[model samples]
Target: MRKEQRVKKNKEFQEIFKKGTSFANRQFVLYSLKQEEAQPFRIGISVSKKIGNAVCRNRIKRYIRQAFLELREDVQDNHDYLIIARKPAADMDFHEVKSSITHVLKRGKVLKKTSYGKNDRKK
Candidate 1:
């Protein structure tokens, strides 16, 4: 994600946490706040020290960012999203992280619905 697309300031994180509606699964928590004007969506990721050392924490954050990048076209614009990693997330691979994030976003209704044809089915 680009710097302009990331929510890096503490103030912005606080605002999103305060005003956003949250959704969660076992591995992650998602907070989403809709903006009044049309703008590109921005994302903030938080993984606490309690979860792991710097390397592990950074890995989780990277996974979350990659998930969002892949889901960008399906995610709603004009919103800010903050993702907080839970303990279980530290052990997950990239695909697992993406799946967990997708579940939370769907529950929050922030992900756009896409029609799947027979070919799109996994089996």
Candidate 2:
């Protein structure tokens, strides 16, 4: 991910928290806000001390980042997203984390609909 495509400023994170809509599952919470100035989506990852120590937190963050990277093209651009990890998230492997992120994003209606089965596609 590029620096330009990350939410790095504290003020930016706060603004997203204050103004954005959020979705959550057992693993993570996703906060999102529209920003026309954002060419591609900007993302921020948060892991609280309650979840674990530094190593554990960093591991969860890495998993979340990898999941987002895989789904970046399917996600809507021009938005800022904040992903806050939950306690259960610390125990999950990469595939679980990816699916959890995908589930949340789908619930949030931020991802383009993908037809995985031939019968599911129209036309």
Top candidate, metric lDDT: 1
* Candidate 2: tens digits of C-alpha lDDT, residues 1-123: 778878999999999999999999999999999997748898999999999999999999889888788778788999999999999998899878988888898888898766222222433
Worst 10 residues of 1 by lDDT: 114-123
Structural RMSD, model 1: 2.2
Pairs of colliding residues, candidate 2: none
TM-score of 2: 0.90
> lDDT per residue, candidate 1, 40-114, as tens digits?
999999999999999999999989999888788888999999999999998999988888888888899988767
Query: Evaluated with TM-score, which candidate comes out highest?
Result: 1
Where does candidate 2 stray beyond 4 Å?
Answer: 115-123
Against the true structure, what is every candidate's RMSD? Answer: 2.2, 3.7
Model 2, residue 75: C-alpha shift (Å): 0.5
